[model samples]
Target: MARRGQRQSGATRPAPQRRRPARDADGLLPVLARAVREVESAVERSDVRPSVRTKFQVVALLVREERSRVNADHTSSDAYRAEQLRRLDGIATILAKSAARETTLLGLLAEDAVISEAAASLKREMLIAAGQEPPREEPVSRPTTPADTTVRRVVPQTVVQRQLANPFLAPDFSSAPARPPRPGRLAGWELITPLLRSFEHAAASASKALPEPTTLRTAEGLELMPHQARLIASAAAGHRTFLLADEPGLGKTAQALLAARAVGAYPLLVVVPNVVKTNWAREAGLWTPKRNATVIHGDGETVDGFADIVIVNYEVLDRHVGWLGDLGFRGMVVDEAHFIKNKKSQRSRNVLQLSERIRTRAGRPLLMALTGTPLINDIEDFTAIWEFLGWIDETGPRAELMESLEETDLTPADPGFSAAARARVIDMGIVRRRKVDVAADIPARRIADLPVELDGAIGRSIRDAERELADRLVARYETALATRTSGSTVDGIDHDLVRRVAGWERSDRDSAKTGENVFSLVRRIGRAKAGLAADYAAQLAHSVGKVVFFARHIEVLDAAEELFTERGIRFSSIRGDQSRTTRQKNIDAFVNDPDVSIAVCSLLTAGVGLNLQVASNVVLAELSWTNAEQTQAIDRVHRIGQAEPVTAWRIIAAQTIDTKIADLIDAKAGLAATALDGSDDEVAASADFQLEALVALLTNALSE
Candidate 1:
């Protein structure tokens, strides 16, 4: 970064390069040549930071614009035109070398590489530095297109900067209008309903044949499972629309992110459930580290509009849908696509509208409908998901689907049309892979951490409370040290003193019920996390079936149950508060009922005497005081009778005491057991956890 500044400011630059500069009529060419040379030097040194990358992009853009002007200048002689073109070609060659040296820079030259404001300003500065007037901004002549008039639309400041930098969106000359299909035998046949019926009648496995992957590793060194790589490989082969119905534990988030990168889908829009929105951004950072991703919370006050990826939850789609349509996303991914099965729902409408806008603008944008399971009884929802994929519209099949149906040479009147039609739709990119299908690639039992950011007022209050608690602990430690009776001094923090102080605080809170203690604080965090955890579990239920949801507190369990009921997902609850017979009955219902998607279990009670191998996925909604309790709950599903690999999704609130406790559990209790069944830690009560957490918190405070 410092080198980039030096290169731009010229404070440390050699004077010889500028003193004997070659002359050009307008001087723009020399400026571009000099910048490109600097970029080349940066590339050679492997120091292509954001500023250098922006400089490289601005240089390319200027060279292209200048070349176009030079070609169109009727006043300039052929000799002059030839000379300018040759010089532009020379700069272009350097750009190619710079790109070759730093292959990641090549992505910036792609069509969808967004021109950041910095790059735009750099372009103008270069022109002015070369003794040419900067281009004037044309007034936007378009009239106001009022949309969501009642809804307050938030345009983040960064987004405004980007908009102001590039007022005119790059035109889509790549998409030529599609020729209307030749009228075939299936012409007037009300084909969409039959297409819906075909899926029902031909209820075979809907997984599509995928291309073999050329590489299984991402640029960030994350290796893809074989099944996941197959889908990414298919996307690279130019298959845009996909209904990725991979089961819950199959790393769908990673696959979706990598697939987006495969096609260079920048300014990508991801519509996910509220619970998993933060997880989506985290996965984006892991799989596509070079790209910037932002999550839209509330009215999107904190959103980074300049980010390459925009993640939003379905609940707030109504508020931001208006501007999201105009955000110039080249791709759309609907996670848990079954959420939009009802086209009448506002979420469905917003997603479809956004998909339509992306398709209309991007010509052929990448559209993926991700679900674990299709609504078996509701073909209407499948139609809605297909609509979101742009495979069909209101009246009938879209151009792509219609063309595929035409090639099959069969109508609904034909004998084998159902099977053929379903096959064609599957080929249009329906990829379904279950855990058993890729069991060898993953551990038989695993815990996948789903870090959820608690946003809005509730999130802010919790953080405030945590800080207050920390401050109180810090004051206690300082007071104790200032008036030490033993006269013992330590250079660094006194770990013993911190623990004794934490114990005193915990005992006071338990006795007087005064300030927030670690126990009560944890419960508050649990309540805050309940909705997110439940929402994630709902997604799992929709995608796959038979998930176990375990929460430490009844309030967390109750909150989760309320959410599941609101979402119309069938669930059975097994709690310590329930009668023995009632608990058994609920457990039996969960084990036996196909409609029961989730079994909400108590971490303590359900830890013993249960064989719930029916579920391969577990949702640990709240943290347990002991590792044994949490391990026991997950073991119900990850036990001996389980046929497929199991995944326990641990939901932790990011940037809070919740994260600290989770880390402590993994480190102090035991890290991920991997092939081992359980942790080596003893099963102590919640008091031990409370003491340790407070100790860790106070120690951190004193260190700061």
Candidate 2:
């Protein structure tokens, strides 16, 4: 069998010697065709051991380079050049279709994307196949002086003192040895895809049963729910790692802390989103009062280096990861694990690197990844989560999972392998239970979409803006089709063309602020609807005791707050610009003070972590771009302790893109339901939402 990282010997053998064309077209066409065929086959057969994403990136990068070359080749005749350009366009069309199947691949086509070593090697091989010399690598120069080359970390005095006080930290590797691969039918295949596919194909039922607990209460006098207790018991019984994916408001924070206590995994480390850093400390105090907890602020001005528990946010992890790794933390917990879904992200890299260090220093330390929605867009979202729990690494399954897969003695081609593979991973410790399954333990929650009509001149202007955006996109699409060579047109609207046009517009929208793209149009609609939504929220606050109002833009929040003030309704504001202390104070006012009837929140700032169960009704003044953000907003009010049924009033504008986005959000929500809630529903990936929304708008405009 070929070893890992070894290039396939016959993968891209050079094409047979032939007369090179005057222009790159003759030399590149056959090579591009062969490369595309090879990549498509690899993707179809799942033979790219590292990742199909890498191959996709390679194809995309090559397509971009070849297109530039074909367009600039001046030596060829006009007729010949046009013919070559058409063929190149055909290859590009194929690349677009491939990317469309997997929405994540579209991100690799960005202009500033960096080429990895593997991708560069593949590109060189393709160039060799085309009988062209690849570009020469530039030599990297080294810094000459120590002052110029030395790397330093700005360690705080307190952290330095702690490290100096305990200088002899030993590495621990006593958990278990790497299990030998057993003789089986699936002995040498790339198993990650098959493993992930198992989750995709398996029934979305309640997760497998956890071991029964020996205790039901914490030392702090807080009673544990049956499900929470089972997880604690599992940890107590030596199950040191878990993907604790119980739905929100199910006491996940309490369960994680108590589980640490059960295993004596103290000197614990908790990495959470910035909004929840303070909340983690609060939860630690409530559930594990005996253990001292400290929250690290910038520069650690008042950090308690001696505390038994350390809580840090993702934003500041880079500065503290160096010392935290040396502090000998016996346990680690990452809240909102989905934040690390993109493995290339800096936060994800830092989290994974720190987790690796913890494993080395405290062998078999308790590690947990807690999130309500683990699979946000695709099944592969589980990759980072699994890595955090130490169940799998980038290459493939780690020790424990490999042993289980070996026991199965089956391959992806075998019958019933997916279910068996899923069971194995779940058995490793994936605790998932939805609110509906434990409805009696938590308040019932529902999302009600409230469509409001805009009938004034302002409404007509917003509608006109939407029509103009759609027309612009349709014009671009038609222009692209008209420029194509004859006989390549299709009957229906080319959805691929639609996505490309949308992607180009979205790219332009991101780089420039003046354009009226989908983003700007949506913001305009939000601005137009702000008054109406705020008025509705004020009415709801008067009828219902308290209301939590969420909006995306500062102008919308400003408008909402002004309207509330004008109406004589008391409201508290929580925004991203406020300091930690002020933010916490505002949150406290909203939760504890009954006189505050409304909590006007910035959806991006107050969405994930702050608990606002004091309010049973939530008014979304503007729509969020993703379903996760929307759900996180509503969960603040619908969590565990609320006594009444929770309702989220999503104020969407009628006869506009707002309605389409709301529908798209609902469609995307099914992904989380299928993965975490065990629902058997078909779902579109959230990555496709932007493109699909654009398609719907353009199709609407064309029909009109």
Candidate 3:
């Protein structure tokens, strides 16, 4: 680099000569070697001194030797063949870089050679004039090989020809035909047309039919973030009934309330999970005017009152499905609509039926749904909920909806559909935001795995037992994992397989005398405990900033708590059995206290909107087949205000059925790629899991 820079600064350089060196593909190797030997021999001769020509000869010999070795074993060895090919490609790159630097050097050298030759001729003439002997001259010849070929010289071009040379290198243009424009008020407005049309209509409607602009108030006391405003504006403009699909802790409820104010379309009904009814009511009162919002906890009088907004839970909505119409609500919002994703469920049926009644008076009352895990495990889930809300057209039941989603037979060759039509349908109604694209300013997160070693004596016994019954165990494992069977059942069989293979469940009566079964059980327990501890330690170690550990089972939570307690790790738990008050208090402590390093909780208990941005790590002790549940759990740490990038890590046992289920869950959730544009975690997980491929793997395992 220094030498190159020096040359660039217009420093003096060595001259070039026509007698430089002969270049060849293979033929010049012998000549180069002879030149090198002669130079080396002369250098070694005490009487002779080596010249620049001798030094170049030596360098050329070394180059020839290296090239010969590269090509010699090119066919016999893959490494050598690759090396030779690499060198061939590298030559052009090296030459291109070298040409720019060496141009002046070469030109100067060539010119100097002419001067040297002239001076030598003058000296010879003087020597002959003075009656002295003239110096001997060597013959000059041009190189015959590709390597020695001089750079091609071209005649200077006129200014016009130079100016008109191609403007830039050719661009890679797509061969696909352009899409026909969608018919709309702003049809020719290009990419921003949809947003423009929606905004214009919203603005016009707000101006013409709503109350005076001065009558409305910017939300007081409760400060609105920029993203919150974007969410509200987008909701008011995009869908008649918008789904507040932001992740947990992003204040979807706040956005919904603000949007109601924007459109003057209140006298609204807010439906959420039973557990969060009070939280919603409290937020509403704090964010909006006191008398404008009312919470309906099985209160008929309160719901019937002419309040701006009435909030209810899903459980109550199902119970009073038809009665909602009597309230004369202008809009209805569904929170956690994933609960109603199953078309046959009572909640879904009730919501669908109630939608009809609510619309009867208000001209299809604006139906908005809120969910973080929108497309839980399948596209059919979306179809089911959206069709009910009139986001998409309803054909019939599950079978018909599944057909529209094209879960199976989606290939272009499948005569049932065309790719163009599918793309068109997908373009509408789905607007997703991911942690990576929108939440990129957040910090980085990581997950690490730790392996534990077992005692030699116990390990040896387990190994011996496993080896003796290897074939039997494989058969049993396979039989249990059949596609016709449930994965939980398969997991149960694998558990038993491990116990028996490790000789922890002996049936012999005499075996009890030496306490063999008891000892083996102890060993087994130790192994399991070690595995769990190792996983938790690795995850907790990665949680230096802030972290949330999710425990699906009480035993798992107990184990994690015990481990943390023993290690003196600071944490608070929101167990499944805890009261709502206790849950909230602990959550507050985790988020407010700087000393609190981790917050452990049951996924089901804390899956709703509970902002815990104080942490950046989320560890899932176990996985659910439902992507919605998993997503809601992960979003606890990933929402707005999180200073760090949130990472959700899962601890999976290698070669276990748990690994397979985790893979399937990840694949199903990965369909949200469009929604999660910059999500590195999502991209990595997508590569790790393939639901269809996993099912095939399970099938193959069962058959084997």
* Estimated TM-score for each candidate: 0.74, 0.48, 0.34
Pairing residues by index, what is the TM-score of model 2? 0.48
User: For model 2, how does the per-residue alpha-carbon lDDT over 1-704 read when each residue is reduced to its tens digit?
Assistant: 23211333322434333332232455867777766666566544534333455556666667777778778988878898788778877777666655433333444565434455556655665665666666666122332232222111346677677778878866666666446455566666788888887776555662656888776777656777788898888888889888887755577888999999999998999998654565577778788988999988655668888789999877567557788878888899998787687676546777899899888778799999987663423779879888888888877888778888878877788897888888888888888886557766554887866666564477788888887788787788889888977667677877777777877776674523534678778888899889878866875664456889999999999998877765568889999999999999999998888889999999998998889988877999899878989989999887887767677878888779998999888867766676678665545443566676887787777666
Q: Each model's number of backbone clashes? A: 2, 1, 4
TM-score for candidate 3, residues paired by index: 0.34
Q: List the lowest-lDDT window of 10 residues for candidate 3.
A: 203-212
Clashes of 3: 4
**Residue-level lDDT tens digits of model 3 in 1-704:** 34423322431234232121223334433433444454444433422221322233223323544466567764568875675557543442332222222211122122112222222323333333334333355222332233222222121122123224533423223222223333333222222122212222221111111111222235574456455666555545634555445554345677677766666556777777543565566666766664367655432334434467777666445335544545556677777776676565445666777665555556535666776653322445655556555544343222222333344334333453343223323333333443444464323543322122222354456444433333343444455445434446553335444433323223334544533332343334334433354334333442243578776666667777766654456788887688889888898888888877778777778887688777666777656546778878878776877665576756543333344555566556666655487644654443332233233333444345
Winner on TM-score (1 vs 3): 1
Model 1 — which ten-residue stretch has the worst lDDT?
A: 141-150
Clash pairs (backbone) in predicted model 3: 15-109, 16-109, 443-644, 443-645
RMSD of 3: 29.5
Candidate 2: which stretches are off by over 4 Å?
Answer: 1-152, 177-184, 374-377, 443-704
